[model samples]
Target: MTSTPPDDFDAVVGAAPSAVTTPTLEHTAEHAAEPRGSRFDDWWARTVYTPARQRLWYWGAPLAVTLLAAVLRLWNLGNPHVLVFDETFYVKDSYTLMHLGYEASWPADADTKFNAGDTDIFTSAPSFVAHPPFGKWMISLGLAVFGAGNSVGWRISTAIVGILAVVLVMLIARRLFRSTLVATIAGLLMAVDGHAIVMSRVALLDGSVMFLALLAFGCLLLDRGWFQRRLDAKVARRRLAGGPADWGPTLWWRPWLLTAAVLLGLCSGVKWSGLYFLAFFAVYVVVVDAVARRRAGIPFWISASILKQGPATFLLMVPLALVTYIATWTGWLVTSGGYYRHWAQTDGQPWAGALNWVPLWFQNLWHYQTAMYGYSINLHVPHPYQANPLTWLFMIRPTSMYYAGSSLGQNGCASANCSSAITSIGNPLIWWAAAACAFYLVYRLARYREWKVGLILMGLAAGYLPWLLYTGRTVFQFYTIAFEPYLILGLAFVISLIIGTRTDAAWRRKRGLLVTAIFLAFVLAISVFFYPLWTGQQVPFWYWQLHIWLPSWR
Candidate 1:
């Protein structure tokens, strides 16, 4: 006895009653054939497409989930007062960058001094920083508002970015599934996930990278809808005017696409890996445009997209992104004390001939970027927590950001042994389920050609696939934070599949709902079980060991 097709499946492929009906382009064709005033169309508009209801969910759901995220991220944010993990680099860099307009050198005892409220230990000498300044700049905002010596100031920006990321996941899920319930589930998963919580509570660049990339993705989703509406309207006008409809008009004004490009540029400003998203999504946009044109009955859709619209789209996106990326270097550029700021005028060879007119500052910036790239790719120093990208999906080795073991009568230890630790391990149930769901999504996308699944996979690809090439590099599982949102989204999609439509037989719906509720309950329970480890809460040694089901997790 098969269950009815889910409402989300109908929303994506078009409404169908039979459980065995495979979604195909024919559903789109049938949808196009329906009259504007048809009973089904009117009913859909009145119920599912109600503007008032959409507006409420659009504003209300994101805020509700963001508040939950805020509490999770901001509570006890300053615990373990010393810098955790790479916060040693970012938090200090942020303080110096705030004062000197460039990352400055600090003494070997800087961490000890800084933690003891001696925050003014940075010197005027420039430090050779690997990543761009944007993320550190974001961290500086919190430092400026709250004192730099305050631990909360070190992480407040990332915590806020994490909260905003939850909202983005909800908004993006809503756009993809067109269901408030699915959107809320996605947001709730992001809010409660240990990986997200740990990343937010620390001063690290990856969370900022995740937030910017996710925001760019949301912008692209908006662009997809906007492009479709504009295409339809222009095609209708052309047919009404009796003009040839062999090729659709080239759309030069894509506001959302421009916005996505800028956001992606800022994402790259946080980390060079963000360029992968820009490259992947640019190709995705072209493909989506070709499909949209083909569906509008344009015979030369592929050729038109490639030849006519492609160059225009590239100009609208790439150049603006380049500018935005350069804008992020304004502080580095304006400061003469930055490392390699005068390379072209001193040790570096200046360009000859037509390019000799290039500014020395731009040449020096280019030289600095090359040096950064070289350092980044060649970094292979072995570390205890450096997990292979192959093990990242399984989370075999989560990074231990901070850990302090106490024997009895030390640091408030009541038990024989107490441990306060912050581990960047994801909730096992959520992480494993997401990993499994991702594989299923790949198969589903191939079989049904669902654009939504493809889009989600594209995000995962942008965040995860790039690291597969760098297996030899010293990387940690915490890097998965960059792609965790897509993981949550994939999991949410599978959940929707489980909770079949209301139109299913009463028994089927009841079973489906029961299964979904139980799974979510387990997920939440696992999150609670691991919260102490994720947040550095003190717990007995055995209790901490209990959360570590696998030896590698230690």
Candidate 2:
């Protein structure tokens, strides 16, 4: 498989220029080049490489795809007219949060009563929810504008972020792969993928986590380019002045890092699992900085990066993330009705007085954190739809979020028997093929040491590897939605490899394009076939059964 040269930024309009030149980049570009696709290359050069046109594609393509994604996720979004799966928990919590400034409990049969149009469902007492309130607050934003009792309100936020995630992945792929074509394909693939669509159409935390994490990732990518430009400028200045440079430049005004920290903080606000991405990206960014310095001929690059830039990045990211996380609890802290809000006052602990400097609500927040941690860790009850993480990539089993069986003359069933279901399943062609393509990514990382490959792999790992630690706990295939963009990126990266460069032979390039088109066509076909399952549309039972290629999908 072919990998794009790191320093081939010249071929990519609007890419950063680094002062450091390496023999590896020159060699790889030369070796990967073929000499037969002048016509295709000419079109790309004339159309996409023009500065103004490039800008249009950059801004226009993502918005177009986002519109497509929005339409797919929002059509009949209020259907089934009921809270599906975990929406029963989060939608109600969001309703109470908007009204009471915190989540409130409900009656024992709240689901039944609430679905039946009993809008006044919640009790005045606070609920002890394990997750943070920010995601629910996001839901509340939609509920506040669109009425709390409406299904569109329950799901509008996820749908919006879901569309935003499609755009974010496009920008990120553009940065990583340095090809507008690659970015457009990656975004379109994500726009059509059933997994992304399902999570977007539902009221769920994972979709928000996916969008926030991808936003942070895009910020880091921007930071890399911005830092590289600064580094190049500094290196050029030192060389022109003929001064003895001990280490390198110290870049302190890193707005991108802080932006990433803020987004990551929001990610963690949605789910604690986002902390993994925050930690992973912090290490990844610093390492890239060290590598850049070393390649720029700095003798003490490691120490310089660690002592100067490392601390700067840490200060910009970690503390901001911490403060942002604390700020997400403002609703709970300000309200007297929140669960455990008075724990410090009532626990009668010896350290309560010793810790009098801290506010009472802050003290209770700490205690609540401990209790939430325990509750999350101890949740090991078996679930029928729980899938092993090992099977996630293959999509051997996917959870059915909603299902209704009807006989003839029921609910517009035109057949003898029919079923309407909302299944959290991905397009088989995309998910299953991505599993195969990811192996190519591993190979590229090992053989080429492509930094972008490593970054994409880190995303996949951060979103996926943590689940391995909880193998005994109930986990679902839907959790993969958080990292689904990376898989699409991996697939796009592989397809780019197949398509090779503009220099590749005409026949080889055309053949590769054909293969890619055929594969995408297969994916689109599968998605169409499974669309009924994704959106809870009624289909003949045999047609629904036909979509279940594997018995586990049942």
Candidate 2 ranges beyond 4 A from true positions: 1-35, 38-61, 235-244, 348-356
Q: Estimate the TM-score of every prediction.
A: 0.91, 0.90
Global CA lDDT of candidate 2, please?
A: 0.83
State the lDDT of candidate 2 residue by residue for 345-364, as single tens digits. Answer: 78644244567687766778
* CA lDDT of every candidate: 0.86, 0.83
- Backbone clash total for model 1 is 0
The whole-model C-alpha lDDT of candidate 1 against the native structure comes to 0.86
Q: What is candidate 1's lDDT per residue for 464-503, written digit by digit as tens?
A: 9989999999989998999999999999888877765555
Compared to the true structure, candidate 2 yields what TM-score? 0.90
Q: For each candidate in turn, give its C-alpha RMSD to the true structure in angstroms.
A: 6.3, 5.0
Candidate 1: stretches off by over 4 Å: 1-63
Clashing pairs in 2: 34-503
